[model samples]
Target chain A: MHIVDGALSNPVLIGGGLLAASGVAYSLKKLEPEDLPRVGVLSAVFFVASLIHVPLGFSSVHLILNGLLGIILGWAAFPALAVALLLQAVFFGFGGLTVLGVNAVNIAVPALLVYFLCRWGLSAEKHLLAKRVADGLFLVFFLITIWAGFALYQLYQVEGGSWSVTVNSVSLILFSGVMAYGYFLYRRGILSVAGFWGFLGGSLSIFLTAVMVAISLALSGEEFGKAAEFVIVAHFPVMAVEGLLTAATIQLITKVKPELLHAVR
Target chain B: MTQVLGEVSRSWTLDKHQQTQEAFLQSLDPRVRLLVCVLFSCVVSALHDMMALTLALGIGLGLSLFARLPIWTTVRKVVVVDSFILVLVLTLPFTMPGEVIFSFWGWEASREGLFRAAEVGLKANAILFSLMALIGIMEPSVLGHALYRLKIPIKLVHLFLFTVRYIDVFYKEYKTMRMAMKARGFVPRTDLHTLRSIGYLVGMMLVRSLERSDRIMEAMKCRGFDGRFYILDTMKSGPRDRIFAVVSAVTLLGLLAVGYL
Candidate 1:
């Protein structure tokens, strides 16, 4: 979700701007001069990839592929994603000028987090570590789902019922189930270690991006609470699609061009 | 699918052909244009008064007219942006608690929420229109160079430039692969096969792009290229740029005064 201009408060805008600028600077520092071509080319690849709309059902969804970018580019995802976003804003008017920083942070932070959380699993030797990480994440999400279920039940009892709350809680529980099934598949050896990590990173990045977008929106004003919740719920399908796509992509990359995965780091 | 491809190709080439046309914004100094765009966005986003926001939107529309941008295309793009914010705007009236303006399905739509939504809509449109008029007309390479002159990090600028340079290339590559898949009778649908095939396509593209980058690196090295990139086109602010800057500064200040006081 690209947040349009003027929706965010001044404080949130400034904070996001500063954070994004520093991220770009830090990533730039980590970038060696020689690595420029590779990073830039991959950045272009990502930009084009985002333009590719995958048929979902009646409608289609464009690939964000931010998690795959993170896996391939590591720290470089910040600048890569920022550049892509700027191009989108300028060329397509999809996003605006002022909210660029906030949008960048919302999309790229999850990418960076994915990089940190899943890079280890890319190695065949780290299969055990990958399995453990997947299981741990599954347990964490399971616990969260249970806790949120209780809270939602309490909310429903108190407020009688609200459509937004019901939709939100149900989607979240469904989302957790999706994650658990993904992990279950990984644990059952249906997916390779790298594929599992790819699935995790892909879906997790989208999940986190949706959450961050929601937080940014809700933090701006109390009136945005409903819209913020709706944003997360709307992204559930995208998360599952991206997860499966990333898993397949990572599996292919690991088989054919494994060096590309570690090229940036 | 072909319509989507056509749209992508058209948008990519749209401004390039238009750049040859003598437009007011195309004639201005890129750095001034860029700075004014950023300033306008900042000021417009900060403005809360509906009157001032409306004025800002007028200025935006006026600039687009002066820039001689395609009228229907510009309006269509603005509409696209509005559609994106529609969710937030539509929910506002129902979500915000205030004096009820209307009741729909037992849900009260608030007057304050309606005003807030209108305000957001105005601010967003104003900034977006101005931004498109000012910066969207510039060559992306020129924008990169302008950022470099504006003292943005050189590495970031280089990345921007290189990314801009290669997006077209990779887009063509993507089209080629899509064509090959189409030749093989691969129709994209809502299925695991489609997802996996697209994923494999992306992976293949990445693999090829990386290999191409390696060759590109060697080509550059063979030409005695170093880490330092030289800027050949020096931007100078002329009398026209100076006059435009003054007018913009005054207009921005006037908008702020009208909005705040």
Candidate 2:
């Protein structure tokens, strides 16, 4: 997901830089001096978390965990991730200097989105409301599934099933299957409301991040369109894996130290 | 787990050892180095001409040599970064519509696409090599202080400092926890059980770290910490830093002229 230097257009790069700077400034204003230690500590934890690569079939994928970060840090996720990205670029050369802003925006915006979308559903006290929200979220997912089905059909008619189209169709079907399972569990009272929200937040954040990365690439040039589509298709497994991991992590946090979920807010 | 820990520690600790070495790049003021790196990267990324991009890459190699970066290790790092964009570089030639260079299985590889791919590869490597030389070798905390002096938000800098300080501490904590899991006959695989175990491990780490932070906050408060960190070592740019800056600016401008002409 780290777009290298020179891959992006000038306008996209500048726009990303401006947006990230403002996000850092705004989050800094909201951050209390005393809260610095906690946020910093959590930020370090996230940096380590990203280093943890979980197995997926014959290969392994490193954890992004931005969804869990958003659930924990809220707006603070932006600065924490920006600092992390900067560190990665400087020390590890995982990303480039000029494209740091674009990379941060691609990763952090979904984190911010998940923070707003999932924060309220994290409470057991709001079980009913959380359930309602989860249902509404699944409703949105159902609509997306329908839309994806149509898109897949249209692509098949036009392009007759390229690699990207196959991957897209298969992943969307897999995702819909996962959503159906979650909806089933929620209805059966197998998954708690908070767990359900965690599942949604985890997967939704990754999905959005993948989409944003694709958009940034596609917007950069016409040549990048295929690569951009491949980017989104490739991240489907990551989204599923992160979703389950996030749900499990949230469940553990709620059981061990519930306040950690609410600490940032 | 041990290999991962070793890699992390190596990346973080290697710079400290280099800081003690009498390298030319290390002698320059970090703020000047930081500014020059950002400027150089910005200029290189905008260049499209092949000759200019190659020249920019040569300058990056020169910077790395002056910095006295470990040759094989620096090359390996640059190669690793190039591999990240291997997909983009490979696909560009076939994706763009232009004069057909060759056809493979009915897929046309265009001349324009191949050139674009080479340009991207060159630009990315040039920036990466220079960036690693100038900024990557700095002590992480010193980099944070440089950012602070450069008028970045103090809170963000503070956060950066605290994070740099504790990444090692938490990684140690993480290693111990993973050891315990290993002792319990736990092995990770591509399964829900593995994901759940890792997730639980991460949650446990976060809980422990938060508790540790509370103790850290109390300890600092006892020392009468007023949220301000005093810099005992002042950063003063000397004559050498001035010369380096001037030379770098001229080289960067020259690269820009080459790009346009």
Candidate 3:
């Protein structure tokens, strides 16, 4: 999801812009001349992946592939994602050019972190259990980042407010419950098949939805209560569909190109 | 599925619009256009006053008209991207806390939220339209060259250039892979099968692209290509370009002064 222009305050915008600039600069330095083709191909893949729409009941959810891209590309995801976002803004009008920096940060930073956190889990073990665990950890990490960042910010802004308290409590319980269930599944190896991707995908979509809610509250200046309501009530099933789609993709990759998975690092 | 395919194809051809248009925006120096758009966006982003934001939006609309962009197409593009903003604009009145403007079903709509939403909406629309008129009408290669001349990092520009160059090719490859799957009696469904198929499609595309890039690198090296991109189209700011830049600068500065002071 793209943050529209003028939605964020100047400090956040400028801060995000600077951070994204640094990331791209670093990625540029790290980019070897020989690897330009790899970057280009991956960038194209990332761009097209966003265009793939998985059918939901009434509508469809486009593939974000943020976690997948991050794990594959590492720090390189920054520049690649930035260029894709720019084209989206210019051509399809998916995002605004003015706020491209903030949007890149929102997607790329989380992606980089996921790469660092989950790469080991994905690459270390060949069993389906490891995949499930990696995906679960990614979901857990995402949930915690959103809660700690946004819930705390809201709490500080309106000390002891009922709305802030309610959001924090709800997020903590819901997120913890998901993580616990995911861990339960991971431990039992119940989804130790092709469906592991689906489970992970579902978790990732839900995590993204939660993050979107938090962003709307924190950056978009939406009343937290309303934004949370819209996300939780309206987008619940889209997460499941996204999860299924992601699962299928991972399964396919594992079957055909096992080397690609390990080679990403 | 076709909608998605249509969008991909459409995005790839967006650069063609710059080639077709003969508007003043197209003729102006791209570097000037880039700088002005950035400056105007920053100004629009910093704007708080409603009148000032509306004024900025009017300028954006006016520019689109002058640039000879299709009005309905521009509106549709802006609306598609700013749909979330539209929701915020509509709901802010009811959700934002301030003096009650109205009440419906025990929900009080506030005047302050309405104003804030309008301000944000105006800014969003303003920037969207301005960019469509400015950046939307520029060729990607030219834009890349402009960024290079502006002293942006060489690597980033090259990546941008190559990415733009190959996006369409890879998309076509993706289409071919999907078609091959279809030819094999593959049908998309809400199951592991469909996802796996798509995954295979994506993986296949990636493998092909990696192979293709190697070939491309060889071709470039064989053609005496260096790391730098050289533009054949020379940029000389004629009196027309100079006049447009000055007018745009004055208008933007005037708006900032009026909005802030």
Off by over 4 Å in 2: A149-157, A160-162, B1-21
Cα lDDT computed for each candidate against the true fold: 0.84, 0.85, 0.68
Model 1 DockQ class = medium
Off by over 4 Å in 1: A142-181, A184-188, B1-21
Better of 1 and 2 by lDDT: 2
Clashes of each: 0, 0, 4
Candidate 1 per-residue C-alpha lDDT over B1-261 given as tens digits, one digit per residue, 9 for 90 to 100: 122211221121224557466665677788999999999999998899999999999999899888777777777888878999899899899889999989987778999999999998998888888877888777777788899999999999999988988888899899999999999999999776897899899999999999999998999899888887788777788798999999999999999999999
Clashing pairs in 2: none
Q: Which RMSD values do the candidates have, in order? A: 3.6, 3.1, 5.6
TM-score against native, each model: 0.92, 0.94, 0.81
In the range B1-261, model 3's lDDT, one tens digit per residue, is 123212221221225456455565776778888888889999999989877888999999898898877667666777677776766567667767899988876668898977877887888888888887887777677777777778888788878877877777777777787788889998777654675567556667665665676787798789886665565555566686688889988998888888989
**Candidate 2 chain B minimal-lDDT segment of 10 residues:** B1-10
The top-ranked prediction according to lDDT is 2
Candidate 3, residue B157: CA error in Å? Answer: 0.9
Better of 1 and 2 by DockQ: 2
Tell me the lDDT of model 2 at A116: 89
